[model samples]
Target chain A: MLAEMIKFEISRLLKRRTLLFWGIVLLIALFTGIIEYLGMGTPKRTVFDAFSFSTSSIMPLLLAPMAGFFTGGALVEDSRSGLLSLIFSKGVSAFEYVTSKAVTSALSQMCFIGITLVVFFVALLPFFPMGSIYIGAQHYSEAFAYNEPVAYCFLIALLFITAAVAFNGIALLTSVWVKNTFVVMAAPTLLYMGLIYVMSMDATKVSLIDPYANLALIDVYIPVSILHMVCYWAVIALITHVLAIAAFSFKKDYM
Target chain B: MNEVLQVKSLTKRVKQKVILQDVNLSVSEGEILGLIGPNGAGKTTLLKIVSGVVRASSGSVWFDKSAGIGIVPEQAALLGDMDALQNLRMLSSIRGKIGTSEIKQTLKRVGLDPDNKKAVRNYSLGMKQRLMLAQAIMEHPKLLLLDEPTNALDPLGIIDLRMLLSELAQAGTGIIIASHLLNEIERMCDRVAIISGGKILRQVNLRSTEQTPIEVTVSTAYDWDILKRWAESVHVELQKLTPNKGLPRGILKTKMAVSQVISELQSAGIAIESISHVGPNLEAVFLEYAQLEGGVYR
Candidate 1:
């Protein structure tokens, strides 16, 4: 039943609106190309430089909400349509259904963001040179990107994808308590920005845990370790998914 | 007939608010039990509990584990992005027992065009309601639970539903319906359980229980005394419904047949201007239990 549920949820996601996700990816890539053409960043930058710039500029701020738009309020819509009760009547447990929603929402966002990030990098290849991240010589340059340029691009893209998944989970979690469509989409972004604002006021620890810095893999004053930063967002994602599943599974009344 | 379903001491509470309390009811095979109540009366909650969509805080619902169950929620539960066929197809795929032909036939039965390409989102409320009914009845479950089944339905759609439900009952489907439409309930149900304030006030039989009292409306040309005497002789109660400003009218509450009451009134030499048995009006009974908080109902 869980497999069937995932299969059905995936099919529903593949419906027309998901094109909007790919549209955002392409739009981000095109904006990067335009900025590079205008020579905004360091001159003679590589595809790795441009892609990293794209993630830093957009992935931390705008991309999380874009992830919200992709899959956030879906459970609410299903509940409003009375589809959850209908599906429950068909013998699908609440746990299974919510798990499928979490899996589909997270993986779909991750896959879509991951693939589109790579495509954005490939699309930047012709415009920018294929030099290494080692030549950037900037204060915030990713040393992980210095040795193997492709691996660096892939790892940074994976980090951004993980961030998307976490924000998407947050959106899904909020929707369980709040039914409004707009709130569900906007909640994660607000939380991200709000937490960043609160953390920024802490002068000592702020440098080590800036959410935007962690997500884009670029530190502001001091670089947080890559493994610790990755684990931070990963834990947030796991907690959100767990809360969403528990709330839905133990819900007293589905109506 | 064997009992197909039994609910015992069912209660549901959310936080400090109680939604249902010690509500006990049952349905025999082929029986249609109507659950009638006003808003906030826990009609939908009780139906949800029976349908297994809502859990009771404390109680038990007994039924055969293998019997297929179908439910029509108060709101249409459908994939609005898909057309009717596609919605049914997706649902049917879960059980893997239904085929395309049956899906099409079910759609046709509900008066929706099986080939219509229009998405369900664009459908009118009546159409969506019809589709909801279609999905519930498609698998022919032995136990059918319907909540506000006639909502947003056109007259024709309602007539279709009446026929369909009656047919399903005839085929031995045990049904429990929660609706505000008392006339429909009186017309269809074998018994009605009146619920209010999260409790079952009374379960009145609409059919098969001959002892159910009949309310006869009467207007007599003679003084009200004549009718009162006749009512007293027959051991029936007489109460004036309207003020004596118009032609005097009174209601005779009696377990006797309408024919017998009519004959008795004639023999009493009472000039009967007009009189008729109102039969059993579930609406009046629902109001009676709803308005009077203290009584046998309490």
Candidate 2:
């Protein structure tokens, strides 16, 4: 059932009309790498920096809210357009319906991340030789000896993924109550930004239970505390997602 | 016959307004039951409740001898971006009932080309409705519930649906259809329940062999006393009666000789402005009952 859901969802996302959104995102990532390469005259940036540049600055603005809006929109559209009814009519319960969506959206996000990893790595491989030349010419030979922050990069990558997965759950939750995609997307994004702003005001007491507030922890280097904080938020998101599915299945009516 | 669906005292409320109240009805195997009513009469709501898409505030719905219920909502609920075949696959795979071949057969019966790869959004409304119906029938539900199944169907499509439903019923499936088309209901239903103001105003059985045929009409400038006396002189059994303001309308029906009524009208000097022969059809019953319930029929 999960496989079938994934197949149909991927088919829907691959439709011609939706291709532009995907194209634009990929183009931005490629262009950002290309411009940075041309300006610096070399690819001295580490893999961590490349991934960080793509996910943090470019992807965050669109990908974060887009994933949320898309998930939420799909849910509401299924209900309002009567697609949900047709599924239920076939003997599939509400629990299966909501779960399949969450699963599918997470898988799609994972696919996107995988593609980004491939694209950035392949693009930067050719420029590494030139990067060595520029470093030698600048008399900064120690630049080649710089150790890759493999652990920190992996942690940040995990952090980014956790945030995306949590947003999918949040989008699924919004779908139960808000049929309009605009409202669903805006509400969570605004609340997340609001929480981020509030956290900036007072960093004394961090509530790791709130996933929205946890995005702030991703910016700095990965310490044991931040990893624990991310894990705490992940647990909270999982619990909220379970409760959301319960609310969707056990609720008396659509509001 | 095995009972397919049994709904008892089902009530639904929305924001303090009653949408359905004390509604009791059942559909048995090999039966086609029509749920007919005017707009806002809760016909769709009743169907939704049965389909499990909408929950009833206070009621119970039991389906067949089975533990599960299948539903086909009024809306064409296919994914807009997916083709008809894909939609069928999604629904069938989830249910774990029926196979690709079964879906193809059902779709073919409904004149939908399962091989066509056109997105559902590109399909015409009639085609979409047909696809939706195909999805429902493919489930092979013991109790088939539909809401305005022919809403967007063309003349031929409506005929095809009627024939398909009849065939399904003959195959031991119970079909409950909610529609405003009284003529179609008259031609199809084995039994019918007319609802109004969230209440089951009446239930009718079309297969009942015993019935009385009567022609009745109320016009202006007719005295109630004279009409009553004239009806009595003819010895007509008032099978069903209701006051239409001062012009009370009654089903002055009888199995007596037809000549008896003519002779009595002549003898009593009763002016017969107009009269219609009401048969065991839904139109007359719906209109009469709707008026009796003090509701307007649109």
Candidate 3:
């Protein structure tokens, strides 16, 4: 039943035209990046430099809001459409319903990020030329000493996936309490942007707790940063998911 | 018959406002129980509690575990983006019984085109009602809960629904219907429960085939005094109808009294114009319970 519910949620999310719209937006951003890189007329660089520039500069801005938009209004939409009553009548437990929604939304965000990464790499393929590997400072050098540029790209994709999952979790939690679609989408994005602002003011200590800040570290020892980001965001996701389950379980009125 | 649903002392209070109070009711297999009430009488809340869509403040609802239940809410609780077939498939899948052919057949049974590809958003109100009915009956549930099921139905749709419900009841599906259509309730329900101020005022057994008092309407060219004297002699209650336009009407407790009045009128050289039995209808019974003063049925 859980698997079927997850499938249903994923199908519902996929049917939203906004998913395709966001995919197009991500492609356009990648296109703009390629055009700008071409205009730079700088010496050719390795694939890792292109991946770093695209992900660090563009991915967060696009993917975070996409994650929020996709997940934020899910519960609210169900309530407004009266589908919540129908679903609950089918004997679905609140825990099962919430977890299925959370997992499905997270996976959908990952898929969106995955598509963006593919678009980034594919768009950069023509621009990749024979040049020195653009490994960053000492930490990046140490991190990628034995790995290739593609490995760095994979690590960057993982970072974006973690950030997407975290943002989706926050959006899901907001949706649980907030009944409006606009508020559901805006609350998490606003919180994420605020955290980014706070981390910018004091990057040293705040970056440890900021998933987006860790996600923006494209030229650093990415494995460790990705690990930290995943752990921090995983905790946030777990907490929000648990709270959402409780709220949904204890709610007496679906209307 | 076996009990399919048992709701015990179900009370629902929302934000300190009492919605339903000590509402106890039950339905046996093959029984149709009509829940009739005025506006804001907690009928929908009770149905929701029984269907598990809303939790009661303090009470228990027990259903036969083996005989699953189906519900059709007041609103069209369906996915607007999906076509009818897709919506039915998704709902059936949740119950772990998904069959495409069965869904199509159900749609056909509900007077919907099985092949229509229009999303539910574009469906008319009547179509939506039919779809809701289709969803409820597709599972062949032992117990069905319907709230205002005939709200958007056309006359033809209503007749079809009435027949369908009657057929389902005969097949042993316990149904709890909450509707304001008193005539529909009178015709289809085996019993009617009148609710007022969040409480059940009375439960009337509509299935009783026992004879009730007959209302007689008589139009004559003779004086009204003649009919009054005849009614007094026959010891039957009689009331004069409006306009006194050559017609005197009265009510009699027995059909025999009606015949006696007609015989007396005939023998009195009165030109009889019309005679008819108005009713011992459910509407009268409903009005009696619905118009009680101060929430107390006198």
TM-score winner: 1
Give TM-scores of the second chain, every candidate: 0.85, 0.82, 0.84
Winning candidate number (DockQ): 1
**Per-prediction TM-score, chain A only?**
0.87, 0.73, 0.85
* Cα shift from native, residue A169, model 3 (Å): 1.5
Clashes of each: 0, 1, 0
* Model 1, span A16-109: residue lDDT tens: 5755756675566557655854576465667776776666666666666776687667887887777877777676788998899999999887
Give the clashing pairs for model 1. none
lDDT of 1 by residue, B1-298 (tens): 9888999999999989999999898899899999888788898888778767789999998876456578898888877788999888888776666899998999999899999999999999999998998888787778888989999998898899889889889999999999888888888888999988899999988875345444444454455678877778868877554334467666666767777877887787776666666645565676567658653332
Comparing only chain A of model 2 with the true chain A, what is the TM-score?
0.73
**Residue A154, candidate 2: alpha-carbon lDDT:** 53
Question: Fraction of true inter-chain Cα contacts (below 8 Å) kept per model?
Answer: 0.52, 0.60, 0.52
Clashing pairs in 2: A89-B71
Better of 1 and 3 by lDDT: 1
Residues B1-298 of candidate 2 have per-residue lDDT tens digits of 7788899999999889999999999888889999999899999888877766789999898874233444456777777777888888766776466788888898899999989999898999999999988877887778887888888999999999889889989998888888888878877889999998899999998777775576654543354456677667657555334444555455666765546765665566665544455557576688878778875642
Write one digit per residue (lDDT tens) for candidate 3, span B100-214.
9999999999999989999999999999999999998898989999999998999999999999999999999999999988888888899989997899988888766666665
Runs in model 1 deviating more than 4 A are A16-22, A25-37, A134-143, A211-223, B64-68, B209-215, B219-234, B239-251, B255-260, B267-281, B294-298
DockQ: which is higher, 1 or 2? 1
